[model samples]
Target: MKTPPDRSGITFEVGAQLEARDRHKNWYTATIEKIDYDKERVLIHYRQWSRRHNEWFQWSSPYLRPLERVSLRRQGLNAPMFVSGSKVMACWTDCRFYPAKILRVNKDDSYTVRFFDGVVRTVKSTKLKPVDEVRT
Candidate 1:
């Protein structure tokens, strides 16, 4: 697996959701308003549906920070590749399906990806072979 690149010139689609952790280590979901990969952080716009207040209030998460990217080496030659915003299927060891977008392609052979539900994760290319070679 390879480490992901410094996330610059990367943009998330509107309405995209992202996962963020607070100082308390509590995880929450927020919508992406803007991104700054060079800074390794993103501005997340969040709102909570308050049943008690019967209204939605605007909120923001602290700059969502990313950890260092890592990579894994594969035995075979490189296969066809996909670009940012390309929709692809990711299979994890847990036998679950994660639909994600390519966020950054690292020099070390890892990909920083954003899942459909808006969680940013780094996956090794060795672990994530493309399901289809044909580009959509």
Candidate 2:
């Protein structure tokens, strides 16, 4: 079977939660406020920051990304046992939430996450939170 055609000029939806970058390039949790399909841009409000800081970026811009998790590649119609190119916040060594990407998934059901700043460590699943799923 063939995959359905994607919606033209649309990548994300309004009110969808996401991880976004601030002007200083810091990664933070945010939610979609609005979208301009004609321009392919999205307006986002930072979760912890004030509404005054809301900003817009092209919908497909790297600044906007799915919340992260321990992503698996191609389990292919097997058990619903694998998972995304998603973005999520994992507690760093300092216990602060930071934007992290999956470097590896350990057989122990833990993940080896590497922050954008070059810090890497093996972390249990409990310490990770999906970007959109996190309430704050």
Candidate 3:
């Protein structure tokens, strides 16, 4: 049996939920299977139900962010600015702002947003802006 590696500031523990960037810079969730301290990366097993052969695929991490469990941080001075299910605008990598809904509030104060087109993305609070709904 192999011993689990010591936890580092950037390295996550086994079974920790996280999101990592793909080749196209899209983020996807995965679980930490192993940690490589020497290489400063982690082995993540991402589940893909669409795949037939490789249902749980492993990927290395340096581009991974630990999933947040708390909604607010910073000692009550920095509570999350937005709540889940809130309508907001999110900034994409292309620098364009698109309408999205906050799916969840992360411990890091970021949010998982779903765009109008059904694309989901985890973005920082700074990249979000409140939207004023216009009743029809």
Candidate 4:
């Protein structure tokens, strides 16, 4: 793993590993997508993969989700920031984002995002960034 450059507060482009919480609040792997960053926050684009349908879908109506914590797979590598709105390429199967909107910005630096499909989700700031600024 390599260190991610320090681009906090600057809208940068990047790919993200998105996870969604089930009813139990346990995180489950979801789709990865592109993002756009603005200051401390970001706008995320959602990409959804349906196993049952065996296909991929692009969504932009859904708001961005912030990342809480990013960890590197190896030691001493700068972990990736889960910025909002930044675009991410698929590293594996079943990674994508869902179109959503920001309903509210929480005091804990988290956001309440609502999808066009009527799903309201809460995401942290760690998952967003500008679409053009990502390295890959």
Candidate 5:
């Protein structure tokens, strides 16, 4: 691809951790595996995914975004953070965040959430982010 400057204004170097949107519209944590400056293509390896899932995308593709919480909040994607009965993105073992609903909060600040798949689990608050954090 003859890539142009990233429309998102992102300029991440190789090995930078970020988030990438998949074909299904889900955002998953990723790392910049390589960059072909001449071709303007970036090789990304999805966190927790095998090598086969790594992909090459045009540098300017909107499918890529910063994963830093501060950057996300600065983009106006912040909210009350987390609370009971709120919609959230819960991180699973696959390192992919999935949409879930908070059922309650534990004394230790952990949260009991029920994923859309009907699986329930108590996850640390650090492993979750508000669903609104993802700019549709």
Candidate 6:
């Protein structure tokens, strides 16, 4: 199979779905509502669903994952594959998944990861999920 291209050349436009890392290392799937290339930032709108309340939220960030990296439109309907150094969402104790980069593969098959907020942790493979599923 062919490999995906680097995301360095990819550009964002209005209505593009992107995964963005927040200051707390949490990642959320959002749609680009506005782009400000001069400031290297974009405004994103996302939905928040809760038992008590459900609403649409807007946020802006500089760190974003490319559509190619976060999209689930692949050859099959199976889970997306990930490797060391891959960007993923790791489940936290608060029952939330945060944005993190897989640092290393442990002997037991677990992974050491560094969150975008500068926190590091070791987590089981099951506790990890793809950024693509953040929306669905």
lDDT of 3 by residue, 76-123 (tens): 336789989899989998998999999998876679999999999999
Residues 60-108, candidate 1, lDDT per residue (tens digit)?
Answer: 2233432212111332234437666677776565767677778987655
Query: Whose lDDT is greatest here?
Result: 5
| Model 2 weakest lDDT span, ten residues long | 73-82
lDDT of each: 0.52, 0.68, 0.67, 0.39, 0.80, 0.63
Report model 2's TM-score to 2 decimal places.
Answer: 0.45
Best by TM-score: 5
Q: For model 2, how does the per-residue alpha-carbon lDDT over 73-136 read when each residue is reduced to its tens digit?
A: 1222222221323456888878888888777766666677777788887776668887666476
Would you estimate the TM-scores of all the predictions? 0.35, 0.45, 0.42, 0.27, 0.48, 0.38
Query: Which pairs of residues collide in model 5?
Result: none
| Candidates 1 and 4 compared by TM-score, better number | 1
Q: What value does the lDDT take at residue 85 in candidate 3?
A: 88
TM-score, candidate 3, is: 0.42
Ranked by TM-score, top first: 5, 2, 3, 6, 1, 4
Q: For residues 1-136, could you state the per-residue lDDT of candidate 5 as single tens digits?
A: 3444744435557788878887789888898888887888889999998989998988877888877754555454445357799999999889899999999877565789999999999987789987776486
For model 5, the superposed segments whose C-alpha errors exceed 4 Å read: 1-9, 70-136
Per-residue lDDT for 52-120 in model 6, tens only? 321222223245665553343432333435678898999888979999999887655467899889899
Mind sharing the TM-score for model 1?
0.35
For TM-score, candidate 4 versus 6, the one ahead is: 6
Residue 69 Cα positional deviation in candidate 1, in Å, after optimal superposition: 20
